[model samples]
Target: MSHPLVIAYHLVWTVYGSWLPNDPRGSGSRTVRFDPLADLGDIHLGRKRVQPPRREVREFYDHAADLLKHPVLDLDKAARAIVGAALGEVVAAERYTCYACAVMPDHVHLLVRKHRHTAEEMVTTLAAASRAGLVEAGCRDPAHPTWTAGVGWRGFLEHPEDVRRTIGYIERNPLSLRLPVQRWPFVVPYDDWPLHAGHSPNSPYVKRLRAAGRYP
Candidate 1:
């Protein structure tokens, strides 16, 4: 028998305009302007390569890690509302069934079913609309970039077991890490998390999984 057609997608929603500075080696420049952290002074008397300043190095690494870890949205109540509304629109347009969703200060995690959209396409739509939504929600600050360039993680699930594992990982990921924690903000709490809208929560796909006794 031919294998069934099933696909799963796990996407991460990063904070708006909160990307960390990276090494510029690939940007045509041979070196970074001034990495205080990496620039350790040498032993002047001996002109020897002494141990670099640990504190500076540590600070720089810590700072960069924090920045790249997650985004922190500094939106007021009204702005959040707008962002939420806009996100709803994007989700609807994409036709993804969100199993679990968490909105963190700096990022988001969405356990959604793969629709007619690709991971890249979903991210593009979300990033664009979310930014516009922020502005619509009254964040008119020209300095704010609205969103980072792309998503952090986009996992494609090909098996029933993988889907179960991915969902568990996404839900507990926040507790497993530090701040910019994502909170369950918009998962369809009552529909058993179907893949498509209007499909019976117990669609044929799900039945087949159960029949196979592999519905993780």
Candidate 2:
């Protein structure tokens, strides 16, 4: 069957060392770049599957940690806030519309409305801004990487229900990570779709056009 047109994207990415090539939760990597990592554990290239126990998975990454070149990133409360602020700037500067955003300890979830930029571009830009924020705030070392080695994952969202589901999912990511729900200044509530309001009502783009707040 054909897929519906994508109205938005649900993007997710991990912090450095947070997820490995061989993870119980799974990864998107096709090949293990680090030879040492090849035999350390089995690689689960797909997003997720029905295999491996948490105990074994932890042991794998724990041993794998010693073979890494940089420290693992586990963002603290302050660091998450800093990253959120950096992202807020990007929303204004890039003129992007964010339906949901949550900064977790090891990863981030974003529900971004379909825009002039592609989903890949959205992840890249947001990740860059986050890295800059962490470095400038001394939350991260400039020599180390903020995100994973790859481009991360992005799935298209087409329907209004799909968009709403993704919005809820991103917002709840922090809680799943055992962190509190994140409230980023950049995130706007997903109200209605473009066909109804001439644009998504709560989106940054329309918020800009409403009244005197043109272009924020």
Candidate 3:
């Protein structure tokens, strides 16, 4: 997709060693860069939610977890808040427009509107800020790498439907993982985008914000 066509981006990345190339859920990777993980099949899978592999197979992937350089990141509430606050600062400083954001246990998802910056640049900046927050709070080691190695998923959204759908998906991610509904202060509501007028002001997130007394 061209830069101009993109109204927003679905930026996703895993914490270090959390999602291997051969995860039970589908992955964007084609190769298992780690030698121990290579023995497991590297099925070239799309990112869509599919019938997850068998439970045993899912548990089997952990056998190779020892090979990873750093522990998988399972962010608690405090860690999530730290990252969220740091992300809010980046959004404000860079003049980024965030339509949705979810800080998951093992990864993060953000839907940011088109800005003077590129999607990759936003991802990099946001990740750096999160790392700094963790380090400053003494949650992560100063030298520890926070995110997974290699390419993170970047799906560009050109249409309002795409933006709406992604917003829903990001919001439901935590619930699907059996985690509480995450409410981040950094996420702004997606009220009919000026460039594309069909976006709904009454998104699930909007309702959530209203329920929590967090919206205006």
How well is each residue in 1-216 modelled by candidate 3, as lDDT tens digits? Answer: 112245688999878877778775667888777677776665557754665667755575577566677677688889988988999999989988888889987899999998888888888888999989999999999888988865488998755667899999999998987988877776888874643355355765445445655444
Which should have the higher TM-score, number 1 or number 2? 2
lDDT of 1 by residue, 145-212 (tens): 66655455677765545667766776676565463444434555423334435656476776665566
Superposed Cα deviation of residue 6, candidate 2 (Å): 1.2
TM-score of 3: 0.81
* TM-score for each predicted model, relative to the true structure: 0.56, 0.85, 0.81
Model 3 accuracy (lDDT, Cα): 0.78
Q: Ten residues in a row with the worst lDDT in model 3?
A: 192-201
The digit string of per-residue lDDT tens for model 2 on 1-216 reads 234456788888889988877776677876778787778766677866576687987887798789888888788888888888888898889988888988888888888888899888888998998899899988888999989976788888766677887788777777775777777777887765653545555664344344333322
Best by TM-score: 2
Candidate 2: worst-modelled 10 consecutive residues by lDDT: 207-216
Q: Candidate 2 regions off by >4 Å? A: 195-216
Predictions in order: lDDT? 0.56, 0.78, 0.78
Q: Which pairs of residues collide in candidate 1?
A: 71-105, 71-106, 72-105, 72-106, 73-105
Any runs in candidate 1 off by more than 4 Å, and if so which? 1-6, 16-58, 61-82, 140-143, 173-186, 189-216
